[model samples]
Target chain A: MSTILLIEQILNGLQFGVMLFLMAAGLTLIFGVMGLINLAHGSLYMIGAFAAAAVAGWSGNFLLALIASLIAAAIFGVIVEMTVIRRLYKRDHLDQVLATFALILIFSEATRWTFGSFPLFLDIPAVLKGTVILPGGIEYSLYRLTIILIGLAVALGLYLLISKTRVGMRIRAGENDREMIGALGVDISVLYTMVFALGAALAGLSGALVGAIQSVEVGMGEPVLILAFVVIVIGGIGSIRGALAGAILVGLTDTLGRTLLPVLFSSFMDGSAATTVGSALASMLIYILMAGVLIFKPTGLFGSA
Target chain B: MISKNAKRTVKALGAATALALSLGQVAVADGHAGKLKVGMLTTLTGGGAGLGVDIRDGFLLAIEQSGNAGIEVVVEDDQRKPDIAVQVADKMIQSEKVDILTGIVFSNLALAVAPSATAQGKFYISPNAGPAQLAGRGCHENYFNVAWQNDGPHEAAGATANKMGIKKAFIWAPNYPAGQDALTGFKRTFEGEVAQEVFTKLGQTDYAAEIAQMRASDADGIFFFAPGGMGISFLKQYADSGVDLPLVGPAFSFDQTILPAVGAAAEGVLNTAQWAPDLDNDASRAFVESFKEAYGRIPSIYAQQGFDTGLLIASAATKADVKDADAFRAALREADFTSTRGDFKFGNNQHPIQDFWVRKVIQLDDGTFINTAVEVALEDRQDVYATECALDW
Candidate 1:
């Protein structure tokens, strides 16, 4: 309940939010641009973590591992888009969901086939191994702080990419009218492939970064994927700005609720009972936030009506 | 090689990959009138696969090593669901005609299956998941738990906490039934002030907020009991958070199954267990050596539990006729097998009466992680619930 502890919890929430944004941004972009409901986005994230872990183990270089994650995810994303997702775009959301859901099963089993069921080891590089004292006298994980910075940088970079770049313009245009862009001599298929790869790469990078702190294992992506979906829903699906906003909001709400609710309940209730009740409620907090947002805006904070 | 032993398990995983990844490797059917048929219904898919797979591998390995053609095992995956466990238990008893039922890695599933299995007069020798009721007032004479009761590790952890001189402690667990039991069990024996007790969401991977609270609070130690993936996440985060509080926990988190994933973060942490890989005994040493050679990984206590169950069955099968129900039950009750965990006997409730050891997580020179025996925490410990069990012998 101390101010310093509260500050640290807030930072933790921000870090968690940024991680979700990394997943949500790609999901929103894919949905916005192609109208494809990609449930396998989490699979790409899992692939990123596995690739990072494998590379990191082989060369003993975290940087190389990080690079490998992005490359691997992008390559896989492109391959999947060309092979399967390219067809689903013309079909309904149900078909896309069913196909992508199948991809999740394939990816999870294939990853398990490759990595085995035991969790793989991945740690933050030695330089970022421990905590750092923030300006407000709060001791925070250096790795987490790095993740927050990376996430914000990605957000800003994405803003510039979409607004200032030609490719970004094409993507925005494609979102408005896919057939029109194709008729205007832009290879919509190539644009779609590139966009999908970019989205996959973002998800992969998030997975690798988070995998260093958490476990690199099968089904790891799923829980985060649900939260990421919540983020995009709250922020507005297909909107990068919405995804970022929604991710941070969800992250802060979830983390702060988990930390403070028990203390809040302990004020009136006993400790054990308070912890039980608080945590049970805390698990529902994000979904509550999502429901509240959807009730009001329907299209989300940044999503179009 | 980390994957050398994994090759055997990987084959089993490959076997499971085909059937929607729920059922385990079904054995070749060869029913004999005299041989004991054991139904090993356990979780082989979903999140709980690791524990179940380990149990199956260990049980099968022991059966293979004994070269005992007298015992046949039929393995099924309960999918970690209570309904599925019940359904599978019925199948094993009715259709498969397994004379003895075992290999459930969870308590709820055990609670779902054991009462019915024992009521049907099929012997259920548990490899893991000894719920309190099965060891207490609800104890069935036909059910035998080779592993310790549900609160065994926690009760021993409380005792070890006292021995280690921890004065004030922070406790954390997932909000679930077993998690609640863990808290009550720890506090039952602990003679210390509670700095804080926190229950996290089940399946939660991040523990940053809780770590911050631990650092800020006036606690001397931390006690946690998050199993499988959740534990790995917490240990890694706890290490990086720069908190120096000594930790005491049950072996579920620090077992060989996950220590490799947790890495150096878990080094030197103390956990309570009924057996350690480095236990000094003939059966214990032999089991460890062969388990590593057979599986290419260190056997967690889950595997040890399965191995012990196998031995217990083999001993009984050799001593008395399975056709003679009373004789077989008495022979099994004699508990004559040389256990991997030292000085094992069954209390009146048919749960294990054995020593609980304090194991310290240490990285071997070979870079694999294992829990080596540090000290005897509780010698010849018996569960307090045996007196409450009203089953007449």
Candidate 2:
């Protein structure tokens, strides 16, 4: 393989990793603050894509669509938090899982009803429509590059929000002790709602950005949601820093493994057999990594004992 | 005394109603003119729902146009699962006692359900999902396919690619039976070395890794079979990746239902199919116009197959009594129906022998992508596996 190709593949991995971070961050935050496993997080991602598609179709403005996605997902998230998710806060993990799983079905069916069975269109803006020539003369999609940048910016912004702000301080306290924070005169319910909405908005942003490249359709979020779950589990659930690290790790492993394994296997065996084995192994690479990590660090890379 | 007497009267009334209902069922089943219960089993949820929805709409449209009052259709969602399809087929066959079964959009599901239905002596008129196994040694007397075999369009694509003299090409497909058949069919006629043949996960959305590999390959052209969202994702990503190779595939990738979602990325791509909306035939034009009016979207090839199946069944019902298995099978074998695809005929294997057209995705003045028939690629094409069928009836 060419050095240029390797560099490009690495970039692809990084791009994929950052997107996972966007998804994992929200999931970890919700899990950390409320101890609620929200399986419907992916549904929020779908909602964001649908919202962006609808808004872009009507307004023909990418900025407006992005704003619409965030607001729509955030409002929906808050409503879900208030109505259903709040009820599951004191319940066992099984009830939380079942309730959120039901949300996924409800959201998917409702989206299908509204958008019809066909996929909705979300175009990359004109400015980001083409490729950019990197220093090594390798061409990369500008839109994808933009996604990486946006993801990194969001990561940084999340760090700032968590470490430097009063709301962030309250969140940290709540994560440490929910009842203690409530006893200390903080409106714990409102804090949980805001945190849920924030996580949802982050998911929405990722969806809107990724939806331009991928087909915006129903059930589009489940695959990414699974990956995000892996990211959190590996990164140590509820750690944004860990989520970022794990996302990038999983992304690079997946992307590079898919590209390189076949080439490596082809050297020893026939081309077709090598490719079959290589691709199969490549898809399993992430899970293997997760397994390896869990074997050593049972709580994840940053999780508490 | 009053309560006991009331209970006895109620018991008598209930028994009488049960007797009447059973008698009514028998009356409806005994060659009743309009009582043909058809089970429409298709994917109506998840990723494959679009194709199923189209098939359902077209099938229903044809049924409505026929004004067949006795054709009571029972629709069920299979969710694109083979197990679910088999269960639904059983329910329809046993509980609902549907005389005719139709509307399965995927080959895997059809393979699971069609054989069992045919074994029970029920007429299995397939609107879509023509697996090669059923067209060959597995062919049964009671089963008839309204659509072409799974590899029909792919074979045409291969022939077209060879005719265009493309020497080296890269091929990709989802990793499944249909995907494997697609590559095999493409290679049958295209006498060129494949740069690479990659099998991706069925519902994989991101293609950056695949596209990057394709970009680096020394291939002159590309052919892929990624239906539904997979196609949309791959085409859009390929367009953005600055790969300028000529791309070709079966029409499933670039059909009307998905073309709008694919947008500008799909333009100039060539695909092969047995039918297109612009095909100049009375049935084709009428079906397209009415489909748009009914569904507000141009019908995909799945819908055309469904419509044709409806027409085929309706014509057969008029000629033969469905209650008589021999007569119904004979009437259906006559192939006396107007098809959206002109010159449709049934081969010995009960699969369609039809012309396949090479269609290029063209953007109209209103900025909608539609497949325009560029040329007839293969005329009166019959599946290669059809000769293996030993069924004489």
Candidate 3:
């Protein structure tokens, strides 16, 4: 492969990595602060997509749909937290996993019941529907570039909120010691609810933003959920910074490996053989990356070790 | 002693009267003495729900049109799991005592339940998933496919491609059995070099790298076999990437199930299928109009197959007096029905030997787009690998 093609593949990887970060950041935050394994995180992603589609359909305004997704996802998170999630705080991880898994079933069926089985299409907002010329003579999708920008903004905003705000302080405190914060009369339950909602809203936003380029449908959250889990595991169980690093690492490896491996193999192998071997190896690249991390860093590069 | 005997007689009469009334009510509810039990196994509530919902509705419409006569259809969700398929099939066989077991979308699920139905000697009417094994040597007397084999439609695509004089083609499909079948069928007719063959994960959302590879190869055409949501995702991405190659696929990817998701992106895409909304026949026209009027949506090939399976069951029941499993199996072998696809009959292997059509997507006058301009019976399509099938046919 030429230098230009290699560079282009790297950019593709970066874009994919950024998308994963948007999904992983929310997942890690929820797990880190709440100490709950929320399997319905992907469901919230579906909710965002649905909310955006419905609003965009009604108002014919893309911006309004985007805002509606965030608000709707957060509202949904609060309601779920209040009714079902609140009862499971002291339960074991097994119970948490079961309950959240049940939530996935409920959410997926309800979404299907409401939306029917057909996938809803989200139009890329008209202004951002074209391509952009990049450095190294690469022509990237403007919509994809927009996703990277939005993801960066959200990452920065999340970092500041956790480090700067009073709620952030309470969250940090809750993360370190839940009982101590509750004993101090800080309304620990309410703080937990807020943290869960915030995490959900981030997940929702990610869903809405990505839904434009992809599809909004029942079970849309699942593939992303698995990827996000991989991200958090590699990033550390409860670390946002680790999520970012891990997600990007995953995205780049996945995209670049898929594009480059075949071409690289072709130099030594016949065309068809190279392609079969390359695609097979590419699919396994992420797991290999995960394994390498586990062996070397165990807790992830940015995670506490 | 005589007065006590009179009281006992009166109580017995009253109890008898109550039992008669309840039995009368149940008989009226059933509408007949010989209530035909039809078991419908479909994915009622999951990712595959959309197509399943359509199939379920079509089957119901067929029942409703038949005046809800002769058949008592019991619908259950398989949840797209093979274990669930076996459990549901067992429940239908042993508990529900269904005279006929029908309806499935995936081939794996069909494979799971097909043997059990045959072993029990019940007529197994397949609405979908015509795996090649059953078409050839694995075929059973009790197993009857209302739908064509998975390879049938792709065989039509291959014939069409051959006729169109397409030289080089690239194949991209999900890394699954169905995908392999599609590629194998397509290559059977099209005697050309495969520019590229890429196997993607099932339900893969991102197609950027794959699309990039296709663009680089600069193939004349690409054939894909992704069904349901994956088709929508791929088509949308393909549209965005601005790849100028002609795209073709089987009905599952481009039919009514995915048209809404692909929307404008679906225009000009070609597909090979057995059933389309615009088939030029009175039976097909009536079925399509009624289906659209009832469901407020177009009927997919899955739905058509589902409806046909129900009708086939009804026909077989009337012929065999459904109470007799052996007779029903014999009737299924005869396989006479006025399917939405016009005249239909089963091959010796018990799979539908039917016509396949090449279709193109275009906008309708109602401002909605559908598959219009259907080319009929392209090359008298049948599974190319049927020779491998050791079916008793």
Candidate 4:
């Protein structure tokens, strides 16, 4: 790969990593503090994309559409947490998984019923539609670059919310000792709801951002949900920092593996064999990375235990 | 005494109703000699539901128009899973005792059910998916594919690329049986140097890595066989990636069902299909009109295939008894129906031998995108695998 191409691929990897982190952050928060596995996080992502598309269609304003996604997903998150998710936190992991998995089906079917079976269009705004040449004559998509900046902004904002703020301090305490935080006169349930909503809004934001480029369809959330799970698991189940690190690692591995492996194999094997072997290996690269991480650090890169 | 009397009356009523039901069944069976029980195992729910819904609606529309009460259709959702498709096929075969099986959307699901369904003397009429194995090595006498072979459109895409004067091409498909068939078919006829041939993971939504590679490859044109949502992602991302190369592919990406979803990104792309809405034929015009009238939307390529499958069954039903396997097979081989695509016939492999037309995607005044026929890609096209098919009549 040329240096310029390599730089672009790295940017691509970073962009992908940040997107995963958006999903992973919320996932780690819920799993870390609430000790609740939220499989429907992906559903929230879908909700955001659909909401953005609906709003964008009506308003013709991209910024308004994005804000609508955040608000819509947050509202849905609050409702879901209050009505269904609250019941599962006290239950076993199996029960939680079953209930959340059911939520996924319900969300998918309901969305399909509402939106119809076809995918909806959500194009990138004109201002961010084309590419811009970076320093040293490297051309990159302006929208994707915006996505990276937005993701990093969210990450930094999340850090501030979790560390500097009182709620963040309470969250840390809850992660350390849930009962102790409750004893400290914190309204633990309300805190849980806030954290869940925050995570959900982040997921929705990422969804609306990526949805501009990808498809806005039912079951679109499921794949990203699976990747978020991988991201959290690799990053350490409840650590935002680990989620970021792990997400970047995964994004880089996947993008670079896909681009480079086939070329590397084509050097030795025939064109067809190289592509087959390389791509097969490339798809498995993330899982292999996960396994390797677990082998080395069973508690993930950031887990305390 | 009153309770006992009521019980006795209820028993008498139940017996009378049971006898009448049995007699009614016998009468209906006697009424139509060429009656067919068709079992439709299709994707009715989940990600691929749009295609399945089209197939089911179009087929039923044809049946409804034919005024054929003799064709009793029983439908079941496969949910787009191969194992579920197999289970449903078994249920339809063993319990429903359907004489014919049809309406599988994906090749993986079709391959799972068609072989076993055909082996058990159930006639399998393929409407959408036409895998290469069933056309060549595993060609069954009872299996009749009313749709084009899996690679038929891709082959036409190759020819279209040639016509477009694209000398070097970057071709890609998801790494699976049909995907492999697509790339292989594209290379079969195109007189071009392959800039790159990439096999992506099935259901992969992101194409930045591949798009980047495409920009770097300096290919004259690009041919991609990403069907359904995958195609939408590729189109949107490619349009945004600043790579302004002309895109060419088969019609799966540019069909009525998804073209609207793809929106302006797909406009003006040349794609190949066996059928187009603007085909100058009575049946084709009628189908396009009635389909829109019935469904409140334009019929997709899959729907056209479904209508033809239904028509094929109806025409064959008039001539031969469905219970008689040899006679029914022979009649199906004749392919006596006015297909929405003009001049449809079956090759030796029992797949469609029809003209492949190139269609340019154009947006309507209402801002919805659809394809119109521009030129013929291949005349009276036969699947390349037909010669290998050893099914002797």
Using lDDT as the measure, name the better of candidate 2 and candidate 4.
4
For lDDT, candidate 2 versus 3, the one ahead is 2
Tell me what fraction of the real C-alpha contacts between chains A and B each candidate also makes.
0.57, 0.50, 0.35, 0.57
The CAPRI classification for model 3 reads as incorrect
Please provide, for model 4 over A15-99, each residue's C-alpha lDDT reduced to its tens digit, 9 standing for 90 to 100.
9999999999998899788877777888899999999999998888999999999999999999999999999877755566667
Residues A171-270 of candidate 3: C-alpha lDDT, one tens digit per residue = 8888787888889999988888888888888888888887877778887887788788778878876788889889889998898888778778988998
Per-residue lDDT of candidate 2, residues B1-393 (tens digit): 112233332233234222211211001122234567788888777777788888888988898898777777888888777877898889899998999999988888898999999999898988878878888899999889988888899999998888777889899887666777788789887888899988776778888888888888999999899888888988888888888898989999898878989898998888999998899999999999999998888889888888998898888878887898899899999889888898988899999899999999999998888999889999999999899998776
In model 1 chain B, which range of ten residues has the least summed lDDT? B1-10
Write one digit per residue (lDDT tens) for candidate 4, span B109-207.
Answer: 889999999899899999989889899988888888898888999999999999889999999999877888899889998999999999999889889
lDDT of 1 by residue, A30-110 (tens): 988887778788889999999999999999899999999999999999999999999997675666766777888788878
Q: Write the per-residue lDDT of candidate 1 for residues B309-357, one digit (tens) a residue.
A: 9888888988987777889989999988889987998889998888999
State in Å the error of residue A183, model 3: 4.7
CA RMSD of each candidate after superposition: 6.8, 9.7, 11.9, 10.3
Between candidates 1 and 2, name the one with more favorable TM-score.
2
Residue B201 of model 4 has an lDDT of: 90
* Best model number under TM-score: 4
RMSD (Cα, Å) of candidate 3? 11.9
Model 4 chain B, poorest ten-residue lDDT window? B21-30
DockQ ranking of the models:
1, 4, 2, 3
What does DockQ give for each predicted structure?
0.36, 0.24, 0.17, 0.25
Model 1 scores a C-alpha lDDT of: 0.86
- Kindly report which residue pairs in candidate 2 clash with one another: B34-B70, B35-B70
- For model 2, the superposed segments whose C-alpha errors exceed 4 Å read B1-34
Q: Show pairs that collide, candidate 4.
A: none
